[model samples]
Target: MSVSLDPVNIADKLSLIDELWTQRKIAGLNDYEIKLAKLKGEFVWHTHPETDELFVVVSGRLTIRLREGDVVLGPGELYVVPRGVEHCPVAEEETAVMLVEPVGTLNTGDTGGPMTRAAEPL
Candidate 1:
């Protein structure tokens, strides 16, 4: 007998990078989006006005910083930045993270600083 299969998983199909990668999409009734980001080094500081953002560390370590304080997240750790809050992200080494936020949300929020925005995937 022969069998056929789709042979692909949606969750695994979408990767934003060829090596180090990220994946994202708008989801939920509130138009929130889900994102998967992989990183190393430091990211620009920024904020989001209309929505809060949630990050979950899937592998390695992630550091989240704010003007007032900072937090480090390791595997299975999670963090949330309230709407209109300013924050930054950094990874000492390679790290994988998942982010959730509303659709049309700006990666940089109001700052518009360099690295403020992410280009929509083609």
Candidate 2:
């Protein structure tokens, strides 16, 4: 049997825990997944060696610092960081974001350290 779902309030479904960043799995499309994330402060600089990451700002603002430059995104804005491009995401305030990427893509990407951990499936 096939399972399906109705339209969901993505932001409302995210669990706000003690972690500086929280993510909820929204849905999966073939080999890709859509996730909702609530973030604050800065994330480690990393890169996905073989997958691109699509970020859609839901609320507040996010700045993606890249080697070449930085991209600032506001609500309803979207940006895609190509594979192998190093980036660090920063949110001066609490920000809600939606991410679309391949299912196996790690939140920490290529770099691994204290700041890196496999994304917990929600």
Candidate 3:
């Protein structure tokens, strides 16, 4: 297999995204995929039973709300939602985030509804 030596520019990739809550796959590492998403408003409460989800804030703020509490992240910060833990992601304003999860993992997790989307290549 071939690998890219050039950097994957986050800002450039994020610029290609027009819709909120849509994830764009930027790179892949092993069995995990690196994705970028623009988010606003609240997402559905869901859980990934098979893998943990990593959320890294690129711009603005994000809150990962859980039954236990809420984990807030700012630009350059990140949070990991443990597997099988129910959580909802909320962003007051337009937020740019990077998600690291297993390839083929759905954004909506256990609750598959309208918000669910397959991450397409950037």
Candidate 4:
């Protein structure tokens, strides 16, 4: 097996998106992966049945909508969406975020929609 990782600029990995968030994987360990995403709009409501997801805002604003309420995040802020809790992520404009989740954890979680995808290295 081989493993490699390096320092990342974070912002430099975000890709331009016209409609939805674009995620770029930056690093991974034995059980988890780090991914950066450029978000500009709302994502579907979903949940991770197996693991929690951690999101750290790198820039712009982001909101995680839940049945109880919503957790809003901004630059330099972070939030953890507990496993199996249905939620939706929304961004008013271009927002950069770093996500840490279990390896192979689907981006769309329990909902395998068109946006569902395996993370790709930046």
Q: lDDT value for candidate 1?
A: 0.71
Worst 10 residues of 2 by lDDT: 15-24
Clashing pairs in 4: none
lDDT of each: 0.71, 0.84, 0.96, 0.84
Instruction: Summarize candidate 1's per-residue lDDT along 1-122 as a digit string, tens digits.
Output: 57555453334633544434334442333566666666788877878877788988978899899898989999999998888788988899988777777766776678776554452441
**Model 4 misplaced regions, further than 4 Å:** 1-6, 15-19
State the lDDT of candidate 4 residue by residue for 45-109, as single tens digits: 99999999999998899999999999999999999998999999999987888999988888899
Worst 10 residues of 3 by lDDT: 1-10
Model 1 regions lying over 4 Å from their true place: 1-16, 19-23, 26-30, 119-122
Against the true structure, candidate 2 has what lDDT?
A: 0.84
lDDT of prediction 4: 0.84
lDDT of 1 at 108: 69
Q: In model 2, which residue pairs have backbone atoms overlapping below 3 Å?
A: none
lDDT of 3 at 17: 96
Candidate 2 local lDDT, 51-112, one digit each (tens): 98999998899999999999999999999999999999999998889999888777888887
Best by TM-score: 3
- State residue 110's C-alpha deviation in candidate 1, in Å: 1.3
TM-score of each: 0.75, 0.89, 0.97, 0.88
- The runs of at least 3 residues in candidate 2 whose Cα sits more than 4 Å from the true structure, single-residue gaps closed, are 15-18
Best candidate, lDDT-wise?
Answer: 3
